[model samples]
Target: MSAPLRLILFDVDGTLVDSQATIFAAMRAAFSAAGLETPTRPALLSGVGLSLPVLMKMLVPEADERTQDQLVTGYKEAYHDLRLTQGAAHSPLYPGARGLLEQLSETPDVLLGVATGKSKRGLDQLIEAHGLERMFVTRQVADHHPSKPHPSMIDTARSEIGASQGDTVMIGDTSFDMQMAEAAGVAGIGVTWGYHPRDALGSAQHMVEDFAQLAGVLNKFWTVDHE
Candidate 1:
């Protein structure tokens, strides 16, 4: 019989790429354009895994839906312009990201995927820039799904890839990701190098400090049935 498939889904912004600076810049510009007080760095980072419209609402709770929509548009415009001018390399992969991906890609029975709050265009640009277009078999973007803490992305990815919940894992930096994984009945792994604090990822089944430690954590899951 064929081995059970393992689907590893990753969050983009905080988990893989360190795009805080770029994101902060765009968010600041967007808020300014919308005539609102710019959110603090911590506030912006805290909202990393949420969709733009949801984030805008959280950042500016008093704003109406139309105003929130305008903020989302402004944020997208500013972010796109920043990428165009600074190039996609502005958001560099975290240390050991490529090595971890390379190792996972070479492992049999492993299939990679992404479930991120980034728009499809944004995710595509990041993937293409880092030559990771071939790494992820499934891509779930904010454009197509509700924000994190919702299981739609994970459910869809699992269904599309024909992977069982027991064999799927969601790796991300936020509580939202962990919550989503829990809601989807999959395992959730947290990385400490991302935006959210370690305490915030309490829902994760495992937490790793760096890429060197990630493989071992994942191996625990991979070898579970065999043991």
Candidate 2:
């Protein structure tokens, strides 16, 4: 709580937004097209942070890399063409989401940014629509860098924000996010409003239930100096 966090990287889908219905619809459609059984939303939701390749593996056990690539491509196409719009048609921003981002933005020393697994195009669309583009200094997404459980995105976020690992915190709804933050040497802040639960955020220094607590935790973890 006394680390003086300077940069806070937030995951989009689960942490900041709730696109579960849309994501499930997309995954259901994707799996159906792939000749696989569509999983229940609860099953697919928990695996949200994994890369497409990994997703394909889960969906189709015998899937090879080439097939995985094709399946992922198909999934993205489907998601882009149909599900994303349907999902964002009615947003799922958790309580106090806007207030917290607004607060973070108002704090000049705070370098607000998006570190998500969504593609840059997808991230841009959501951020622009939500009026968050201006609030965020940078948006690091999937395909632009390696996936979670690898620290590339988190590392890139820190570098883009000119932040030291000691001054950074990665907040997300997935265990992979925790792993990524741990690998990047940053505090992993887990949110219960996201995909995974408290038990999954094993490496997280703190797990918060909502944005009210999120703000307080950030204050405790970060010093006003911005490190």
Candidate 3:
């Protein structure tokens, strides 16, 4: 009999790609264009998994909806300019990320998906630039779903990929990801080499310090021990 299919969903920023520098630069440009103060790195990183408007609101709670809208527009413009100028350097994959994805793709029963706060355009750009258009089976973006911790993205990805909650795993680097996984009744695996601190991922079913550990954890998850 064929092995059951399993779904592995990944977050883009702060999880697969180290886009903090670009994200910070874009935020700074956005705030500056809106004549607002730029938030600190830690403050901004804390909201990495949220949608742009939600992130702007959290970062500048005092700002009105109009200001938040302006900031969002400015951020999109600035990030687009940066991507055009820097190309793939705007968002490089984390160390060992590609290798592990390739390994995972080779597994016949494991299907890969993306559940990220990035817009569909942004996600497509990243995937195309990095030659990852063929990597993911289901691409869930902020364009069609609510923000992180809502479980909407995961629920959709699982449904589209035909995977049960018990056979799905969400891998990310933030509490939002873990919370989303819990909300969706899927396993959450936290990676330490990202923006969020390790302690913030308490809800994760497993934690890995690096992609090497991630591979091992994934193996253990799918491998049933027959004692």
In order of appearance, the predictions have TM-scores of 0.97, 0.90, 0.98
Worst 10 residues of 3 by lDDT: 218-227
Which is the better candidate, 2 or 3, if ranked by lDDT? Answer: 3
111-200: candidate 1 lDDT, tens digit per residue:
999999999999998898888988999999999998889999999999999999988999999999999999999999999999999999
Q: Give the whole-model CA lDDT for all candidates, comma-separated.
A: 0.92, 0.80, 0.93
What 10-residue stretch in candidate 2 is worst by lDDT? Answer: 83-92
- What's the ranking of the predictions by TM-score, best on top? 3, 1, 2
Point out where model 3 deviates above 4 Å: 225-227
What TM-score would you give candidate 1 relative to the actual structure? 0.97
Q: Which parts of model 2 are misplaced by more than 4 Å? A: 1-5, 83-87, 224-227
How well does candidate 2 score on lDDT at residue 214? Answer: 88
lDDT of 3 by residue, 1-227 (tens): 97778999999998899999999999999999999889999999999999998898899999999999999999999999999999989999999999999999998989999999999999999999999888999999999998899999999998887898889999999999999999999999999999899999999989999899999999888785211
Over 86-114, each residue of candidate 2 has an lDDT whose tens digit, in order, gives: 54553467779999999998885678877
The clash count of every prediction, one per candidate, is: 0, 0, 0
Evaluated against the true structure, the overall lDDT of model 1 is 0.92
Q: Report the alpha-carbon TM-score of model 3 versus the true structure.
A: 0.98
